[model samples]
Target: MTNPSTLPDFDHPPGTDLWVFAYGSLMWNPGFPFVEKREGLLRGYHRGFCIYSHQHRGTPERPGAVLGLDRGGACRGMVFRVEAAAVPDVLRYLWQREMAYRVYIPRRLRVRTDQGDVRALTFTADPAHSQYCGRLGLDGTASLIRQGVGQSGRNVDYLSSLIDHLAELGIEDQGLRELAARI
Candidate 1:
């Protein structure tokens, strides 16, 4: 469990648009409204199944894997630009959805898009967090995905959903595909 005080605060003035990067479930189902969205590439971090999901996709006893933006490499994902007025509601929703375990630390990083560069808010795994698994071997990851079920449903379904969404975005992740096939 993470202390609420540890969560990062999003304090932005009114009338300032905010950009958010979505690499996992948010890629498919962003509950918040946004004015614009674009495919973005974030360097210095890669999306990997490096966190043990003990709430949404599994229990503590049988944890499933969830995607996290870990150090190194790069990630291709969707970037959403929310109008300033909508930022508050979006932050509230994201906090409830992604900050539960505090496994992810909210961050503002630069993302490259066709329109140019923008600083976007994103989540990266807290390597020190108890749920952080760093990088797990493919087989071990597959086993967890095969057995996990939680509030959001089957862990395998989550993985499948991510894979499907990636494909739809014209993003090819061989590592994720291999992990999915390994099971």
Candidate 2:
């Protein structure tokens, strides 16, 4: 993967807004300011517990799993509208937070929203990355979550929060729900 530092800055023209696609933690804690938000759908990708987190959620010795936009299916998420002037700072922050080890590939993905279809900045799982754990069975996933704890908090907390947020949105993720129950 290319260095995130070398990626283009997410700058918007004077009158344009920066739309961001949030499929994971960003849905609950964006950290940056956004003017508007709406339920959105991103096609050609589905949220999966595919990344082996060795920092924020666990250690290298016993990595925790985190969500990633894996290819196939569709993902129902939130799209945030960021002010143009804040794009630079927000992009910087996102790079630092999400690209600690370049486990994701930054891209402009088409998101379907009430406002219409628009391209938004999205971070997708890098399947070739060392941290990519790919597909895991519910029991295995739960086992990892049960043993994971990192700088941020427990892995179960992360999985539970995502499941809870999806429930609040009326979106069902059966696999995750099953795993959550096992944990």
Candidate 3:
């Protein structure tokens, strides 16, 4: 559970090439410039409904379930390669977007793509953070997810979108399926 500010910018030269991993909303809405995209497999981390969304998907009074890259297992997600010219701006956009709640700890992980393995920037859960609700069981998770409605619309919609995107990529998440079914 590290703070993003303490780390370097992927240790790359200013305005250089970089890769970013997207497992949740980012996969559908990166909100940044990128030249290449691929379905990459990230090991040593698993996606879970660990974060409580207070704005994007729900309000403080009724937080929504959101995905977080937790320790152990693996996750199949999308990876984007930002060109050198777009690196700085993309990084800035990413930092602002993903770090709003400071609930995620960004890390550089090796993602296995069809082209090859790439060291991409990934946002993992900060277990020590206040927003970290961890595994709240399937029924409990579905409850929060169903009751949530915020600026981004319904929390159920977000889960549906994620499930759709994952399905399009031929990725199967049993936990996600059970949660989705419960909701």
Best by lDDT: 1
Poorest stretch of ten by lDDT in candidate 2: 2-11
What is the TM-score of candidate 3? Answer: 0.88
Writing each residue's lDDT as its tens digit, candidate 1 over 1-183 gives: 443334675444457999999998798799999999999999999888889988778898999888888898999999999998888778878888888767888888899999999998898989999898766788988988898899989989988888888998899877789989987
Among these predictions, the greatest TM-score belongs to 1
Using TM-score as the yardstick, the better of models 1 and 3 is 1
Off by over 4 Å in 3: 1-10, 13-15
Show where candidate 1 strays beyond 4 Å: 1-14
Which scores greater on lDDT, model 2 or model 3?
A: 3
Task: List candidate 2 segments past 4 Å from native.
Answer: 1-5, 8-15
| Each model's lDDT | 0.86, 0.83, 0.85
Better of 1 and 2 by lDDT: 1
CA RMSD of all predictions: 2.6, 2.9, 3.0
TM per candidate comes to 0.89, 0.87, 0.88
| TM-score-sorted candidate list, best first | 1, 3, 2
